[model samples]
Target: MNVKGLDYTCLTLSIIGAINWGLIGIFRFDLVAFLFGDMSWLSRIIYTLVGLSGLYLISTYGRICQVDDAR
Candidate 1:
């Protein structure tokens, strides 16, 4: 995927992860687990992907700053 596509995907996953964390903190609920069984392989994979997405999103800060500077 192109950078923009990848960025969007990462952002989306990161947002989902954040929402999951919010639910966990507020209601002791895990949306992934609720949907995919408790700590199942699929749930673990989802968690891992979310984490990687978060890491990928870290680079977005520099990209955003560069874009702003370009204008």
Candidate 2:
């Protein structure tokens, strides 16, 4: 995928991860763990994907700034 597409995907995943964290923080609950079994293989994979997406998004900072500058 192109940079923009990748960025969008990463951002989406990061947002989902953030929301999950929010839920955990406020309610002491884990949606992924609830849906899947607590720390199941599938849940671990989801956590890993979310973490990787967050790392990928870190690299998009420059592009984000450039876009803002253009506006």
Candidate 3:
């Protein structure tokens, strides 16, 4: 089965955001913030990207999970 390119990109970004949050919970470190500097515009942009990526996942979750489409 071939997944759409956009779906793959969104899924990859979602996984990245999830892992970043997981690290934050366990280590009190935000990787994106650390690299971009907290409170900086770059940091905010990273946060926003992650948030939007998550929202995209929520919106598309059902559509992506249709069993018939997987085959």
Candidate 4:
């Protein structure tokens, strides 16, 4: 199966969230908080979106398996 545009978006957001987590672990820095404000509405929204994107990406495992199996 081919990946959809929504999958691309979710994957991108997940990557961004992962990067933010890495920064927090390594440097106690938060890119989202810095850009949007600490726990502000915008930051919360971004956090929520990133969380949702991570959740959505979980479902992609089956799609990925199908593509790999085809190959």
| Candidate 4: segments with Cα more than 4 A from true spot | 1-3, 69-71
Candidate 2 lDDT over 1-71, as tens digits, reads: 99779888888888989999999999999998999889999999999999999998877788779999999
* Total residue pair clashes for candidate 1: 0
Candidate 1 residue-wise lDDT, 1-71, digit = tens: 99989989988999999999999999999999999999899999999999999999889889889999999
- Judging by TM-score, tell me the better candidate of 1 and 3: 1
* Best-to-worst TM-score order: 1, 4, 2, 3
lDDT of 3 by residue, 1-71 (tens): 35577667777877888888899999988888788888699878777877787777785768757865888
The 10-residue segment with the lowest total lDDT in model 1: 55-64
Cα misplacement distance, residue 7 of candidate 2 (Å): 1.1
Evaluate candidate 2 by giving its C-alpha RMSD to the native, one decimal. 1.7
lDDT string, candidate 4, 1-71, tens digits: 35688898888999999999999999999999999999999999999999999998888888889999999
Give the winner by lDDT. 1
Whole-model Cα lDDT of every candidate shown, in order: 0.94, 0.91, 0.79, 0.92
Model 1 regions lying over 4 Å from their true place: none
TM-score for each candidate, following the candidate numbering: 0.92, 0.85, 0.72, 0.86
Error of 3 at 68 (Å): 3.5
Q: In model 3, which regions exceed 4 Å deviation?
A: 1-3, 65-71
Q: Judged by TM-score relative to the true structure, which candidate is superior, 1 or 2?
A: 1
Please report the TM-score between candidate 3 and the true structure. 0.72
Ranking by lDDT: 1, 4, 2, 3
